[model samples]
Target: MTFRQKNKITVLGHDIKAGENCELSFGVANLHTSSSVDVPVIIERSKKPGPVVLFTAGIHGDEVNGVEIIRQIIAKGINKPKAGTIICIPIINVFGFINLNREFPDGRDLNRVFPGTKNGSLASRVAYKLVNEVIPDVDFIMDFHTGGAGRFNAPQIRIAKNNPKLDKLADVFGSPFVLYSKNIKKSFRNTCHKLDIPILLFEGGKSFHIDDQVTNTAVNGAKRVLNHLGMLSTRFKISKPKKMPVYILDSRWQRASFSGMFKPSIAINSKVTKGDVIGNITDPYGKFNHFVKASNSGYIINVNESPIVYQGDALFHITTKLK
Candidate 1:
């Protein structure tokens, strides 16, 4: 967890100097079949002195879109940076990514266990390493993520509510939706905010899958941010939204009133008024039917997309925001 010295940065026995780029192998805890889980860090340090920004993904392991976005950045685009360093961690939660799960082996969310202790659980240790070693050394950061399985998120940016500066960064990233989010306790974004390091959380697509449009949004967004920070040159084309972004105040899940075959009447971004029917839950044999209604007037941000549902299951996620 220690670095050799500044200028000649040593991370997990890999030495990186100015203008040097390489894949640094960070050894995580040893497994039965392998000596250690080698977390590859793609480090690129420019000759000119400037800021250091980190692009991180796969914190939940199942979120592959962010991982692919980071991979695309590191593969070729990052070399275009004019000054400063860019560190890309395509997959942070190695165990979760390997198992295609969200939580660590100890049944804890890695993102929710920031600034962890060395003697703590696996998730804690990983969080500790990131908080202590990675984030502190970076000037800015971009954390990419996606919706859970069966749910899709419109390309959006989530920032701490009331933070105007961060909101501007979200604008630079150019997502059509900007969520003024309440910081989750001990989350990666929360930790960064506490440290006063500028960070952006980009959410889009769905877990374990990739969309070409969403991927481009993410890549161009990163390019925009880097360009803003004076690390990368311009000529990067960012996608523009025809409709203005919706500023969300809050969101809540709409639970199914009946256990039955569910069919959604609303799609993502569909506008609805209060008491509007969003979907229908009916018996398999078409005996009983219950129409799901919206509680607050807003756009349908998420649809369960599951054909079958049980009573009390969240079938729709709606927010009280309209643009």
Candidate 2:
């Protein structure tokens, strides 16, 4: 976990020296109306030398909870480090963010396109610029994210298993749960891994929604990591996690048995026994009501909040095994 000290770092073609604070534009394209889009890249550096950390969010655009966590970090002056450089990109997909959609105008998931071609689609080109320009000097990254659609994910950190470096960092992040997941092909996490940059992928709450508790947990985790790296400013106080995180090794989705209105009786992060009633699916006329039972005794990490569901829609994400 030791980082080589950097006195001068170049980001997006800007040569930033020690103790310099700069805000640069990450603009790639303009809107249909020809208006320019500004993606601000905020960089804060300390006179003392330490590791360079990057905080990024809004890869999906609709994941406002992640955006909020970074926003609070910037607003509270958390990005001003004590002995290193901190970079913050609060929103990455400005196109999707402007349209209030999850994908780009070209219908591409920004997260799926990594190390893209210079002349490829809009998403691909942006990915290429990020990989080639901003990421070359970053030592570590913390990309914030949230569950898709109506699924609410409990506060958690996701990392590829068996990497002791990632395992120790995930523990330092101190989220309530740590899930081991494989890196998807061409994903941002995979790209960072290929470049040998350590990253911690955080998931919590739901897209387009922000919970105070979730925000607090993520913010505190960021503080703890910065403190660990000797980069956090002395003005901030680090709070120990109330409890140790649950490490999930395997998990399964509990799908709906019948198509109808759905309500979850069990909350997220709740541990349940096998055959316990966790939710119920019923028709609008009340003619039939089927109670959903837990398939195994484990924790409920994600709960789908959609009112209407199909017969096979994922209703709950329950842990099948733990470490």
Candidate 3:
């Protein structure tokens, strides 16, 4: 297959070529009197054609792990895909990322605004454009993500639908855990699936920080997915990921119950038994303390990092049983 130079497609003011890979900044808007915003996309093309895979991150903005993972992959270089193209969008919500926030300037969760309207809110327009222009060009997508700020998550792949093909892809990701979930109402992955595009969501570590272990797992898992798709050669193989017992947990927020300083006993991935004291929430006066207990036996998949808490603030996210 010979590579030819195709004409350029301009997004906002940046150029993306059809045959060759390029980076382009799309859309421009003002949130305030002085500043404007633009989304960055890196499109890489193989000399030979193959399945085009889109690697996107920062949809929730504060999820730094996914952003970094995408950055590292492009910087390192991907092997030639056997058929199409590869599009990598490291940070889709620049406004939220800059503020270290999970939502947009309007306080809307960008992840929920999928297949958005062209003339709607800033987030909606971005989603609409992404679904219309970018995603339609890909055969598959692998979206990267992490827990929001003040929360932690185990490195895992989320299979939202029951496609055996996708399940096999998730297994090939080689993570210690794979979360079987159904498509959430309006998530980007769900929207893509509606378009007959198979998209896998890879969640690892926590928001706003980078963990080398989690990053490595994400990269290796994505590489395996590419290999499984025949986008890349299968010369490099990874051991089957350890199977952690799968749980369809009825997860709920364990709030502080009162405004106080939280002293947490468990960290992410800590196993706890039912009735175990997970943390202590104390008032300013050394006088009163309330114990935070586990209602069920499970591993602490997410824990609050901040000590200062308000009533109704989420403290822990547990996934019961380990495989």
Q: Name the best candidate (by lDDT).
A: 2
Tens-digit per-residue lDDT, 56-155, candidate 3: 9989888999999998777767533443567788888888888888899878888898878999988898888888777655677889999776676777
- Tell me the tens digit of each residue's lDDT in model 1 across 40-73: 8878887776677889999998998898898888
TM-score of 1: 0.89
Q: Can you write out model 2's per-residue Cα lDDT over 174-228, one digit (the tens) per residue?
A: 9999999999999999999999999999999998899999999999999999999
> Which scores better on TM-score, 2 or 3?
2
Residue pairs whose backbone atoms clash in candidate 1: none
Badly placed stretches (over 4 Å) of model 1 are: 1-15, 241-244, 321-323
Error of 3 at 43 (Å): 1.7
Cα RMSD for predicted model 1: 3.6
**Candidate 3 — which residues are off by over 4 angstroms?**
1-19, 30-38, 79-84, 233-250, 320-323
TM-score of each: 0.89, 0.99, 0.83
Q: Which residue runs of candidate 2 sit more than 4 Å off their true CA positions?
A: none
